[model samples]
Target: MRPSSTLLLVLGLSSTLTACGGEARSQASASPVVETTVAEPQYESIEQFESAAIKRDVPYVPTPQETVDEMLRLAQVSRDDLVYDLGSGDGRIVITAAKKHGARGVGIDIDPTRIEEANENARTAGVTDKVKFVQGDLFNADLGQATAVTLYLLRSVNLRLRPKLLAELRPGTPVVSHDFDMGEWAPDDHKRVGDDDIYLWIVPAKVDGNWQWKDAAGRSIVATIEQEFQTFTGTARADGDRYNLRNGRINGAEVSFELVRAGDETAPVLERYAGKLANGAIQGRITAGNRQAAWLAKHD
Candidate 1:
């Protein structure tokens, strides 16, 4: 079969997707898919036909209504949120976001037919003003303005889109995907809804800098952080000795780290740093050697 005009446009634009300068690329999912390009019609009553305008390479698979609700619920959509539904088959996720949560939504699908179906659904749901659908490549969709994103694409597609997602979306944006995961990005929360897996990840704030402050005990503490997306690997200096930090976690403004080393009091004195990074400083509490103290750090 000759390639569709839309598909050609999408492939032509894939090279610049990471920049997110414009609308979609060529391919979008048009129907529910199993392991391949075959359609497994799950909703014959609502959508009688799966349009043959398969926009993207992935087989079409429309998420069940129950799963759609769970995905949006996990993302905590609100009136203030701008939700983006990638590879949006039939536009169920975006429509639900606008109808149930009162949030504005954009659904991107490669198949023009699917986009039409989505717009029809949105009109029926009385969310036509708040929800819009686009026909383009999900990878090429500009997601910088979105506060929440929903996906039902394949595992490879999720992994491929991971970097752009991390880089384009701002901190604290929650991404909820149904069935597939972002490989190494590690979800902050996940749950199974009726045999379907839903994953949620919140973008972490940038906190990679040198910080220093005095403890409640008048002890000087200095620390350095090396950040990777939402997590960090770093070291802290205390009392003329440097200690390695383990289990460092950075969730948005929240931060925590631990240190364990041999000491006269215990086999290994465990020091825990639980704090928040904000306004160019870190402030929280620390526990070391059976003593608790207020922790504070400043970063320029």
Candidate 2:
């Protein structure tokens, strides 16, 4: 028999013959003294084992509870909110949002171990009805139903997710992150908790391209807008005159700017425009001098 088979047989015989006579003991002792060894599990490295078992893009790191509170606070989570937490280790952020703010939440984690732990945590927190833990890739998870989002991922991961966040989330949805910030895409608010950093961003509406609206005098007003994230600069042409856009800013779907006739800095005529962007049109009001009128602009 092979050495392994011999080892198993010997072990079996030894157990059965323990109460046998001296002859049996002698027979067993005379049998081959086969040396056996238990081979230890082999791995290339600790990292390899972790990679195979966890398959996580970022190592599991739990955000501090205080930082979690601050993140929800920064996002202004409320009962009306449905928060989605990506790479949600232990599901603390979403659970806290549910427990304290009365918000419903979803947590996504790539690791099944983490998802299990997060689900158990939610159960212990008595918020299982308000939150759920999903084992899935955060990159492909559906976020369209979320009113608020939270992240505790690396900067590279956040960058990879930036486009998805913008594409899937509705304008005015709040996104809060711990430690890392979306590169180049600045946060609307930031705060420091203990030694950790918390950041908040309000999803901005896409407002690039030409926008056209007529003034009260019924002259044709065509404004060309150039947008980079939430800030934009553009020029408006009405009749045969060109005007410059100043202080152009977009907060969520809300748009505000000042239109000044070019080269009229000495006593520039300023038309302050404020509006909400929806569909392909903006609807709000324009203020000039002491007169205010409905402002409607459509993207062209």
Candidate 3:
């Protein structure tokens, strides 16, 4: 797995539902101390058979050819996007993404045969120069350069990958999925593709850091909050009482969010504020009770 990247955009990404890897072999105390080798499961093609086993979802349906085309359209994948297809069945999505959109793609699947087949398919589609396939655990795959993602996995698996998807991919990167919906998380846009509904989500930027603000009374407030990807729980004390700030998002150079004075819901400070980060400081305007003020911020 690659290191997590930054989510620097907020396009009001659909909120996702709440949801690591190591390989080791242990010796068994059996007859004659035999060195038993347990081989990892491998498959030639990730067709419905293997997919059902890994995903444990029977009767999995592959995206229809026309549906794939529509998904590419909905995702807005262009010549600039690096599309990554998880559980790539036959590399159809990746091949089509590169061939039709002039984009690049990487297909990750656990079946070596599928990888080889995908590579061959790409060559046949005349997009081999732009599409590549890797045989490995999708959970361990690197998604550092992915500008867009397409998936046809189960809801549980989708939910499990939510954090990694948000933490690794840059904010605003579009994700397209077929049929099944991500639990609790609504899609930014959804449309019917033939008889199926395709969903799209733009990843929201991570919100954390030092920001400066000024109240309508001309009082300056510089607050710093440490963050962990999507959700941030930080404290910014004011007037002898600690104010708890929650929910923040950083989109490119702009940062906007909410905060409460201390932990008390009734004691509110600056209900909402919007600001932008420039150079090494945060400067923006705040709105509260028909009051507006400009604030400046520097890293603490």
Candidate 4:
């Protein structure tokens, strides 16, 4: 049967629409569903995290401003002094030293956050020119250039750091600690600020050996010194006569002691010897009553 053109056109259009609809249904039915997933967070061990984090020997504790001022005072911080504040939390100690005492200062801290905070504080205090902040472990810091040091660390930390302080700092350098002290290493001075305790120590010179010098009367004097920290005991021999040292003390490079002639209980002859130690030699004066004379000593 021959169909009309209009009917044929209609038939073709209908077939095309049906085919398109069927293909669209087939595509929709054959489509695969998509599923969503969330990942779980992974955490490392506490020790591993701590190793990656900032290592602090002592916890961060801000020193009171009053205590800071007292610490600087106890250390006798001057404009010529280069003060170092170890374990500086917000750099208050060093900043206070620079601002109040017109001194130069360095602050060492392990935490970067604290280092940043301290730097900002120094800037605000207008002492940036005289102060600097360093992010590092205090134990590993170089303190040779420091004339004074301040600490607000734990007792254990202070004990652990005592050797480094004594080794690096020059003799006569003053060290001040807030609320904690070096075990068995007595403080040269101590003061109370409110409820906080401030302790000071002067680095002692190494003068524990034989020292020889000439007395006022052209007599040769030989001294044997045995020192434990700043206090010492020894005996001096001159002209075949032995004298026992009394009240022997060393403060930095300054050494002083009194000599009393041995075997003389009553009416003992007393001589006071005072000297400054440098280049392994002592240049000082001996005072016997109203008379004073020059004295020189060399470590042997």
Q: Which numbered prediction scores highest in TM-score against the true structure? A: 2
lDDT of each: 0.78, 0.85, 0.71, 0.85
Cα error, residue 224 of model 2, in Å, equals 1.8
Per-residue lDDT of 1-300 in model 1, one digit per residue for the tens?
Answer: 112223234445665674463332222334335234546756443323444535466656688899899999999999999999998879999999998999999999887778888988988999999988988888888999999999887677888998898779877899998877777788899988776788899988778888787754676867778887677877677798776666788887788877654232243636778888777777899887789988887884
Per-residue lDDT over 36-129 for candidate 2, one digit per residue giving the tens place of the 0 to 100 score: 4558667776644544576566777788888899999999999999999998888999999999999999999887777878988999999999
lDDT ranking from best to worst? 2, 4, 1, 3
RMSD of each: 11.7, 15.3, 11.1, 24.6
Q: Name the lDDT of candidate 4.
A: 0.85
User: Which candidate's lDDT is highest?
Assistant: 2
Residue 95, model 3, lDDT: 94
Least lDDT summed over 10 consecutive residues: which range in candidate 3? 2-11
Candidate 3 Cα RMSD after full superposition onto the native fold (Å): 11.1
Model 1, residue 190: displacement in angstroms?
Answer: 2.0
Q: Comparing candidate 3 with candidate 4, which one achieves the higher lDDT? A: 4
Report the candidate with higher lDDT, 2 versus 4: 2
Candidate 4 clash figure, as a count: 0
**How would the candidate models be sorted by TM-score, starting from the highest?**
2, 4, 1, 3
